[model samples]
Target: MRILFEDSPDYEMVLGDYLERIPISWSRDESFGLLKTRLVAEPETTRDLAEKVMDNREKGGELAGSLLSAIAETSEGQDWMFESLTSGNVRKEASALVMLLNLISSITEPNLDHNLRLLKANAQSVSEDNTHLLLWCLEEACEKERDIFVPLLEEVLRTRGVPAASVYLSRPSLHRERPVSALVLAVEILEEKGLDNGEISLGLIGIYPKNREFVLERLKRWISKGKFPDSHHGMLVAHLKKHDTSPIIALIEELIDSGNRNALYVAANCLEELTQSISEWLGWCEKWESDSNKEPAVIRSLLEILSRLKTYEASGDRIRAIELVQKFASRSNIDYEDSTKHISLGKYSHEGCANTRQENRYTLKRP
Candidate 1:
């Protein structure tokens, strides 16, 4: 609950000002959060207020969904959803239906059948005017339940052709892979538009499993920009998980060779879960060590990775890690040390570090 101070300005006045001015604002989503805070005070009338929000959810373009999506989470807002959908205002209906699609696919209840039936019925009636909203709804729904929405998606693509496919291709999300056919269409769209178009390469659609290596040549800079296991890094991680192959390993190997400490950390972090065998990891270590001019921070991070590696009993497993530890055991690379102690030249009483006898000793960080 918000604490309303006597000295504070009136929420009702503030709400009225926001509701009136926001439609004409240069940016709608900017102050939407403040509007959301004030919006709950009068949920009884939120349906009427939300009708205005839904208007912008349509005409206000992509960013406007911020408020519209938030309002959908409110009980009163949801109660008014079907009313707005069948209210004969195409814009409001489409906006409301997209949120309905988001909810039905993402959450389930006993009455979910009723929602699905209504969704399909309204979806069938979607015309060219509603195609934009239809695709918006399709992306969210299809990603969650391919069995249900892919047919609808396919039908839309069949009817609308490349123009419709181009829409999805431009703004594809890395949250999950789109259907194979949709991606094929996306590839065709890019191929037709030509890779010379700079915008096409920036999309995750280009990274579809087919042209992955080709697209990575363009996206490695972005992957480098990923300093952590962030969403960009996740795209590669997810890419590997999808392919279930080691093609992306070459890319990580390249990043490790770049001699950037963050790149080393990110590359190692990305491979942490790809452990099919010890050889896979040992190969990566050798790749790092093979760089004769490797940065000390990168080497230390490598030490941390191997020292913390899950012990797999085999020839040369952890040998390079031990070798790395032994070589760096005498000198602490404090310049490159991660203050989190994530990377440090350390002497430790760990089973993995038992083989490396070091003069300068600090406890190794552990989970």
Candidate 2:
């Protein structure tokens, strides 16, 4: 049980005070006697007691081994010890649990299955005040006993939402083989519970690339119903741009012709993502320009795209886009001021602008 608390000054200081409160009689047990005594004294406090014991430095390993033997001797002793150690403030309880877990693992040939189950059960009872420690314990359990810890991980995601679940799910080990069932449930919870867009984006990103089809279908359904909020438009577009550009492109085109200013901006941004080159973007402008039914909103979207290209420092692309914009303005008999005002020049270059272009250029041709 080599807990890495020696380097933590706060843990050491807290442990020093915590140990002094425990009666020396508690150290009388031969297995834990020396460890309890040394922990109560000076100089040994600064030393890496856990590491020294594991290394057998000056019989430290023997002392540590005895402590484990004592802990494993009976379920009653283990239960009492755990309850006693954790009956403190949040910091104290966390440190005690961490140390206890390490001690259990350090003993040679220790039976860990039962102890791990106890830890998992304790983890479920943690309150918000001790969530950080609970997450740490869960991660440790994942490393030590993945099969047992996975269900607990799902429970955390289900009850606590993405803020707590992401701490564990984002880990490479879990992220690579993310529990899709849990993630899908989380998405449903997030949607029904109405979490912040940022949190929703985090949840989506955590399960991204793997769940592209699932996400795209959701976005499509949302867009078709005109239920997709502007808050999610950017993140949804970003994720869609990565895996499936067709839906994004179609959505952008539909929104551009819908005559909604906000939706048009969202469409313009999506167009910037889907466009491969200045020539390709110009082609879209030409198509819209030639359309007899193209609305003022479509022209506005084209101007917005041009402004974004300039902001991106795509000088050549900007020039070509600007040329198309000027042609549209001239044909409509609209002056530069109206064009600039309609396009909202200099606004789309920054992040807050609804019409800002994405930097990621896709090579996939539009379907």
**Which predicted model would earn the best lDDT?**
1
How well does each candidate superpose onto the true structure, as a TM-score?
Answer: 0.43, 0.52
Q: Which residue pairs clash in candidate 2?
A: 1-102, 1-106
Q: Which ten residues in a row have the lowest lDDT in candidate 1?
A: 357-366
- Per residue, candidate 2 scores C-alpha lDDT tens digits across 1-367 of 5433454546544444434444212323344455544443433333343333334333332233233333333453354336534565443344335444454344342667666766776766656554544655565566566777767866876777756654443333322455555556667666676554544554565465677667666654554444454565566446555564666556645654665455444444444555665466566666677654444435665667655555633355555555566676677797755435444334344553433332212211112
lDDT of 2 at 34: 51
Predictions in order: lDDT: 0.53, 0.51
CA RMSD of all predictions: 12.2, 12.2
lDDT for residue 272 in candidate 2, whole number 0-100: 55
Task: Give me candidate 1's TM-score against the actual structure.
Answer: 0.43
Q: Which residue pairs show collisions in model 1?
A: none
**Can you tell me which runs of candidate 2 are displaced by over 4 Å?**
1-89, 96-115, 139-147, 160-177, 217-244, 254-262, 273-298, 301-319, 326-367
> Candidate 1 regions off by >4 Å?
3-43, 54-79, 86-88, 108-110, 127-132, 172-174, 189-207, 210-367
